[model samples]
Target: MMRGEGQELLNDVGCICEENGALDLLQVVVGKGDVYDGIWTELQKDHASLQAEIGYLLQNQQKFDVNLNVRHFGKVTKSTIQADGTLMDAAEKIFRGTIDFVRGSADSVGAETEQVLLLGDDVVNKTIPVILCAEENVQGSHGAAIGELDEETLFYFGARGMDRTQAENTIARAKLEAKIQKIGDADIEQKVKTQLAEVLDRDNR
Candidate 1:
């Protein structure tokens, strides 16, 4: 299902399993011009049922940059493209994050992209899934890859300025803001922003 502008949209992007089964899902989020800035969210629930308990979770996140005509300007843009998939009977779960960018103006060319992936429970037992791809085309093409923060990075931050939890909160806030900017309503965007801020604060614990 899909939700349009004006009406706030929330959807469960994933499904659970009662018995063994296969599931496939994909999602695409685009950031457009002035009238298109708004927040969008997809929640996936993997609850176990009676008789037998099985569950799986998958996620994907990607960010792309667009090159518009130089004459077209004054617009706010943001997007959170997420995918979730799970296989029942086998009890397999997957979580992936992909961020792709087509950054920069055509005149002064530059290329950069980034991706991140997250998996849980059954997913960790499986192989590390693919996170990004660059179609053979040159115009500033590169993706800065980062996995979830490592313990060492957290420790380093703790020793310097922030506690481990604080470091995590900082990163989460940055990402949440990027997603909200895509939410297309000023009032709604602000509401989601404040709600996200509260979530980040709680995570700092």
Candidate 2:
């Protein structure tokens, strides 16, 4: 939730040790101006697992830079990080995701992936995913997907009688739907949805 007229900087560091436990996190961000967000999650004990899902939308000439670090330190531990984003107007976003498998974390598994949808001509999107494994017995992987709408998809929207702009709005909103549905609180979810609709609708004008 980083939105304002002036630039914003946020650093959130979290370290937890889990034994036969799990942790899950979801982040949905809609912002203005320039923002730098850092999320750090580390330490997992034997049989522990961690999962993180992030969705961000930026418009106008705003810039959003986010960094996430996940570390595993226990045997048989598991972790996953997934991020999806959309950039409109001259906005830009930089996503840095890192997953580390430390020694003694044998048989650990770690994976990270990022996807970005681009809108407008001058928008910029960059993703840097790093995997560090100090244990040879662990498994780690990383990848990214970045692009615009394809003709086939566009046709699908048109068949449903949705104009280009309307179809795009639907697409943009869809990026965060997964995490939004997990909010559990009906009132808060509706408020967030209202805010997103207002922001996206305003940007369309």
TM-score of each model, paired residue for residue: 0.34, 0.91
lDDT of 1 at 47: 22
Residue 188: error of model 2 in Å?
1.5
lDDT by residue (tens digit), candidate 1, 1-205: 1222233323333333222222322222321111111121211111211111111121122112212111101111122223222211122222323222222211222222334323222222222222222322312223334356677978888888898556755665555456556556798768666654543353321
Error of 2 at 95 (Å): 0.9
lDDT of 1 at 51: 17
C-alpha lDDT of candidate 2 relative to the true structure: 0.82
Model 2 TM = 0.91
Per-candidate Cα lDDT values, in order, are 0.31, 0.82
* Model 1 misplaced regions, further than 4 Å: 1-114, 117-146, 203-205
- Which number leads on TM-score? 2
In candidate 2, what residue range of length 10 has the lowest lDDT sum? Answer: 2-11
Listing every candidate in turn, what is its Cα RMSD in Å to the true structure after a full C-alpha superposition?
A: 17.4, 1.8
